[model samples]
Target: MSALRVALADDQALVRAGLRALLERLGIEIALEADDGAALLAQLADTPVDVVLSDIRMPGVDGIHALQALRARGDATPVLLLTTFDDSELLLRAAEAGAQGFLLKDAAPEDLFDAVTRVAAGETLLQPVSTDPVRARFHFRDDRAPVDSFNPREVAILRLLAGGYSNREIARSLFLAEGTVKNYVSVILDKLGTRDRTRAVLKAITLRVI
Candidate 1:
C-alpha cells in the first residue's frame, strides 16, 4: 500500500516539526505543512492528502473555520483537530464543524497515528478524551429527552462506536458478524435519533448512555 499522505497545520513551528518527525518515522508522508489555517487552506487547494491533522486554534482562520470552509466548498476530506487543552466546548464545536476526529497534543504517538488512519479510512474518532465534561456541559433541546435506553449488547456496541470502531472492527471485538454489527449500529442510531454515527455518539455521550 502507498504511504498515508497528511496535511499538517499548527501555529507553532516546533510542534509542527515534532509531529512531522514522528509521523515520518512511522512511514507517513507529510504532504504539506503550514503554520496557520490560511496557509493550510491555500496549500490544500492543490495538494491532495489522505488526511488533515491541524491544531484547533490558529492566528487567522483557525482549524474549525478552515474545516467549515472546506465543507462549504463541498470538500469531504477527513480532518482531525488537535489541541493542548481538554476543552469540552471546543471539542463540541469541532464536532459540530464536521471534524472527523479530535485529539490532545499529548496523545501517545500510536494513538495519534491510529486516529489519523481511522479518519482517513472514513471512521470518526474521539478517543482517549473523556466525554464526561461534554455531558456535563451539553444541554439537549427542550423537546429531546434522555430517556431512550439501549440493551446491554447495544450498549457494548455504543462503547465501541464511541471508540471510533468501524462495523468490522466492532464485529471482531464482539464476536459477531459484520452484518450483525451493522444492524446493531443502525438500531443505536435510531435509538439516539441521529442518522450520523458521530452525532449518535455525541448524543449518547450527552445522555450519559455510554
Candidate 2:
C-alpha cells in the first residue's frame, strides 16, 4: 500500500519535529505540520491527509476545537488526539468531539505507527495504558460496553490487567491458577483481535469493557 499521508499539530516545535521524524522512519508521509489548532485547520484546507495527529491542549483553538471545526465543516478526515495527561474528562470531550483515536504524548514509536495506521484505515484507536488509570480513578461512564464477544469474566480480568497487574498477580487477585490466568489472557487477546496484553488492554478500554 502507498504510504499514508498524515498531518501533525502540536504547540511544541520539538514534539512536531520528533513526530515527523518518527513518521518518516515508518515510511509515513508528512503532508503538513502546524504549531497549533488554528494553523492546523488552515493547513487542512489545502492539504489532503489521511490522518491528523493533534495535541489536545494548545494556546488557541486546541485539538478539541479543531476537531469540532472539522466536523462542523462536514469533514470526514480521521483525527487522532494526543495529550500529555490521561485525563478522563478530556478524553470524554475528545470522544464527544469525534476524535478517531487518543494517544499519550509519550507513546512508544511502534504504538504511534500502529495508531496512525489503524486510524487511517478507519478504526477507532484508544489504548488502555493511557486511559485506564483515569477511567478507573474517575469511574468514567461505561457508555460503550464491550461487544458480546468478550465475556464478563474476561472483561474482569482485562480490567485488572489494565491496572498494571501481572499475570500471577491477576491469578491471585481473581483466585485463578496462574496457568488458567495465562490461558484467559490469551483468549482475551484473541477475542480483542490483538497480539499482546498491552494491546488487548487498550482495545478493551477503548471498547469500555474494562
Candidate 3:
C-alpha cells in the first residue's frame, strides 16, 4: 500500500515540526504543513492529501470549523483531531462534524500513529462508548415501539453499536468485559438484521428506532 499521505496543521511551529519528524520516520508522506485552519484550507485547494492531522484549538479558523468546511465541500479526507480536552460535548461535536477520530495531545507517539491509521481506515477515533449511546439517549427518547426479537439488554447494546462506538469502548462504558462486548456487538448486528455498525445506524435512522 502507498504510505499514508498526511497534512499537519497546528499553530505551534515546534509541534508541527515534531509531528512531521515522527510521521516521516514512520515512512508516512508529509503532503503539507500549515500553521492554522485557513492555511490548511488553502493547501487543500492545490494539494491532494489523504489524512488531515489538526490541533483542535488553533487560532483564527479552529479545527472544528475546518472540519465543518471540509464536510460542507464534500471532502472526505479523514481528519484526526488532536486535543487536550476530554469534554464529551466537544467529542460529540467532532463526531457530528464528521471528524474521523480523536486523540489526546499528550498521548504517546505510537498512539498518535495508531489513531491516524485507524481513522484513515474508516474507524472512529477512540470513543469510549461510541457515539451511539449518546445519540440513542438523545434521539431515541420515545418508547413507542419495541423489538420483539431483542431483549432490553440487547437493544441497549445495539443502540451503542448504532452510535458508532467501538467494541472495547462499549465494553468499558457498559462495565462489561471486552469479550462480552464483542459478543454483544455480534448479537446486536444479527438482531438488527444489518451487516455492520454504520449500516445498523443507517437502518435505525431510516426506521426511527434510534
The number of the candidate with the highest lDDT is: 1
lDDT of 3 by residue, 66-176 (tens): 989988888889998887745556655676677777778787888778878867877765443244544544443333443455676766766776544677767888899
Q: How close is candidate 3 to the true structure, as a TM-score?
A: 0.69
What are the runs in model 2 whose C-alpha is more than 4 Å off?
Answer: 128-209
Q: By TM-score, who's the top model here?
A: 1
Cα misplacement distance, residue 72 of candidate 1 (Å): 0.8
Pairs of colliding residues, candidate 2: 128-202
| lDDT per residue (tens digit) for residues 40-106 in model 1 | 8889999999999999989999999999988888888999999766566777788888999988899
Residue 135 of candidate 2: its Cα lDDT? 46
Candidate 2, residues 1-210, lDDT tens digits: the string is 799999999999998899999989999999999998899999999989999999989998999999999999988899999976646667767765778778888889998998888778766655433565544533324435446777778888887765546677778988999999999988888776778655565556666676
lDDT of each: 0.87, 0.79, 0.75
What lDDT does candidate 2 reach at residue 71?
93
Candidate number that wins on lDDT, 2 or 3: 2
Per-model TM against the reference: 0.92, 0.65, 0.69
